[model samples]
Target chain A: MNSHHRWLLDQLPQWERDGLLTPEAVRTLRERHAVDDSQPGVAQIVMGALGALLIGTGLIAVIGFNWDDFSRPVRLLFAFLPLLVAQLFSFRTLQRGDASPAWVRETAALLQALTGGACIALVSQIYNLGGEWPDFLFWWMLLSLPLVWVLRSSSVAIFYLVCIAIWSVDRIERGAPWHGSPMIYPLLLLGLLPFWPGWPPKRKLSVSVRWAMTLSAIVGLCSAAIFASERGSNFFGYNEHSFFWLWTLTGAALALFPLNQAAIMEPTRRKPQVVLGCLWLLGYGIAMTFRDTTRYIMEGSSFAMHLPWCWGLLALLVVFAVVALIQKRWAVLAISSLALLPLAASPLVKAEGGYYNSTLSWFATLQLAGIGITLIVLEFAGKKGAPRLGAALLSGLLIARMADSHFSLLAKGIAFIAVGVAFLAFNILMSRLRRSKQLPAS
Target chain B: MKSLPILVFALAALAQWAAPLSQIWTHEQVLAKGTLVRLKCRAPDPYDPLRGRFLAVWPEQTDAPVPDGAKIDRGSQVFFTLTPGADGLSTITSISTTPPGTGIWLRARAGYVYDKKVNIEWPFERFYINEKLAPEADKWFAQNIRGDQGIVAEVRVLNGRAVLADLSLDGKSFREILKERVK
Candidate 1:
């Protein structure tokens, strides 16, 4: 039997002896969920993934040695060798995997994808082929899609996400515009929808699958954000406000998405998506409190509604809010509302005292207040680790503002002392409230 | 039904191999039998990670007369028919979308328009070289001189396809220069 089932079987006898389960019940349960030794275990899946990665990397390195003395045909053979082996493995997996273990199929699919990339890269090496990195990655991604679709392997899907990350980064480096079929990324992502967490509800995702999904989702969103902002900044004469709004709105949506009822419930409390999203939100919030950040939006056009990304950002925010509302995710709805504040305030930033001098300070203050309130609410809702993080964020913002603000040394010192006192008083008050609640009726 | 996955895998594999192989074949064919034209070009250093390293180049400032009121649209494919100048360097005699009837011609796209001069980018602008040799090459060419003339490349043109056949500075191959410098 696979190790998971073996462990469960071991536990049942102990449970029966303890009277937690009757002997008959244990027998029935064991019979219902029969353990099959032939099925792939978690170790097998992990080992298979590692094995594929190693073999692929090894073959590429062998090719990289570049035996230039070899004849052209020999070199060509070397180029195709990895691909041939990978294809053979894939064929075997396809033939046997229906009766074989999940690991076998997953490993074979992963190897096929990796070997395809190896073929592309090694052929380029062997032929001394010169092209754009993104083009190479695009070829790899395109080639791997069939394996992902045919086998429905999560590993290949992760690999595809990695390829997209590299490709998008390269595209951005080349200063490509967003309008050049930017929708292709999301469309490509749609092909792997069946492998996502919620589909086939009874199927549980392995930890690696979860991590891969979380990471790829973040990378995909960030890439789009980067592309959109870069397009605005370079082509449309939009200032840093465009980037900030786009980034924060995307961040807020990702962070609050887990709270949505529509979100797939994970077996674990600390979902990777939620964690990543919170980090983005908090990090962006902390950044807005800094003085230099104001310069990003100050020099040029502060915020023009005419810029394409501005409208795009607003539209995305509205969509996220609408979705959150439908899901009845109060936290997400509340967080998404933060997007409107910048839209409302951007026009007001161009005031009598110049953009930075008046608007930045107020905006920073409002962001801090909003984040602080949100964290406090989340902490009360019993989100583990929120209280400490929320307090740290608030204190860090206070310290940063003090460092750059117009406050006198004496005023800053007084403010610091006051904050310290307030924290102590709040802690004392909270303890007292808890103590009183714990007390018996008087 | 069992063969479906295998068919899909084979097709995908063919596609992956076919794309680069086809590009290489076309370029190789042009390199082998295409007509050669030597043109002076100016260089800017750029590196493509997958493609190793090369110089991003532009044609030397030319006094080639534009046909009266030719619309210079950026990124639109345009052809430049080549002719030997007094200096024996290839120069654009005329620019059009249609192929020229006579001597070797270039396939280039019209870049940004400045006054009446339309900057055109030749499809074979890149001169792929060893990654290690690029920094030195970039420094050498950034001086913008080939023994009192600009750097020149012998570009091979076949039908509409162009391939960079050879890059020379002072009539010396870049490889020879690298070898000499290494010694």
Candidate 2:
């Protein structure tokens, strides 16, 4: 049996003796879990995927040989044949409905998406139509996106999201991505959202899908800032087009989304959106304290992109904020109006600088220190997890200090590295400790 | 009701196939009737996962003599006409805002421009070849360039679309080079 099943099986007898479970329940559990030893493990699944990848790679390598002796029509035939077969497979799988295993459906959908792309690419190769790669990608994605909906395939949905991210960021390094395409990118992303979190009784998006969508949203958000430093400064003037605008807009959007409640559900009380957003906001807040970054950071809701896509979500910060004014839930009203805070701060903030020894830096240090102490006090008053969160905020705050302080660049680098090492090491240790019953249950 | 989705999936699959099919139809039309032109080029081999192995080729002519009546930037589409130069290989002679009324021409995205000269990026930058011969082709092209024989691309152009018909080194295909190496 897998270690997880063995461990669970071991727990059942103890729990029964303690009256946490009945003897009959324990017997049922043992029977269900004992058979798990014969089931495929994660390692086997990973190996299967790797094996498939290798075989696919080999096939592609052979196909890359050009089949020079074959006539043009015959080469095109090779391109279309696999795709046609994959379509027939999809039809069969669809006809089976839910009777077939999920992997079968997922595989059928993924194979269709991939083979369709390969077919397009092979056609390009055979025809010797050498153009921009994005043109090929655009058409491939255009053709494949529908399969995500028609097949109800999360795998294709994720694949489609990735394609959007790639397509949106093309030529962004030059700060001039192809116009119109990137602008409508968020709308394209939104097209998939209404279908997610499932339908009927389930009513929830899968965690991986949610995380994928979140990551893609972040890429879109970051493009605003980086793109602003180049294109926005020229057209919109700098401050009006910065990350400050992005955050305020995003924060307000998230706040408006669940409208008064957290993006989370009952019982756990875990605010994933708020906590993560807070971490990012803290980092942004610290960067703003730097002298060379631009004094205008505090001037307004700075995270706004040139396009004012502030209508977008910030990782989810108001989840942490206690402030509620005006209409009771509006972290907005006058809240969203923060879009105007950017006037001419762009004039002062150049591309680089720090707040070391600056008044703003000292003030932020005092504010975070005070909040950390207050949270510790709350923890002492019997709140669980408060002290941990408070301590993390303080340590992160200290790291921010080390970043902006008068330390040499190497010293700062070493300090950051050690902190990262500690961060990962502690998590690993905590997980083991919790499993061994040495650490307090979270 | 369930059959409706299967029908939709069938339609989606047909739509997917249509894109590559159209590409084939267009290119086949060009190959059948388009003007064939040879251009001297320096090529380096690279692998595109989708398109497989191909040469990223830099051709002899990169700029139009003088750009007339058009604002050109790195991404703007610019049409340029090709002509035979002293070496009897095609060289880009001129750029026009609109497609030229007469001679052999192809469309290219404008690259960096300087000194009133419009630089161009060739649409036919990649010349697909057999995978085993790709790295060999890269090395052989460099050698042949120094040895005074050149790698030339045979391109077919019709109505602003250019297809890389073939690549030959000193009038021989890379297949011949592979045969020599296997021996």
Model 1 Cα lDDT, one tens digit per residue, A1-442: 2455678888998999899999899999898667664435667767887888888777665655545446645766666777778778777777774675778777888887777677666556544454566777787887888887566566777788777766655555323435432425666666566553235533444456566766766666556655665555655455445556666666666655534232434322446755666566656555656656655544422443555655655676677667766765554444345445545566666544543645665775677666666766664775422444456566767877787789999999998887777666766765685587799979
Instruction: Kindly provide the TM-score of model 1 when superposed on the true structure, using C-alpha atoms.
Output: 0.73
Docking class of predicted structure 2: acceptable
Off by over 4 Å in 2: A1-58, A132-135, A167-170, A175-184, A194-202, A234-263, A266-275, A287-359, A366-387, A395-442, B1-4, B147-149, B170-183
The prediction achieving the highest DockQ against the true structure is 2
Q: For residues B60-162, what per-residue lDDT tens digits would candidate 2 score against the true structure?
A: 6777755556687766777888997777688887888789999999988787778888777788788787776666766676677765557788888999988
lDDT of 2 by residue, A1-442 (tens): 3666878987987899899999898988888777342233445434533443454445456667778668877888887888888889888888887675655666677777777777777787777777677767767776777666656666667777777777666735442443644656667776676443233313334445655665666565455444544454554555443555564455444333442333333222233333444455455545644555435554333334334344334333343233433224321222232222232334333333433224444444565566565655554554333445556666787687787689999999899888777656655764674476665757
Fnat (0 to 1) per candidate: 0.17, 0.71
Candidate 2 chain B TM? 0.87
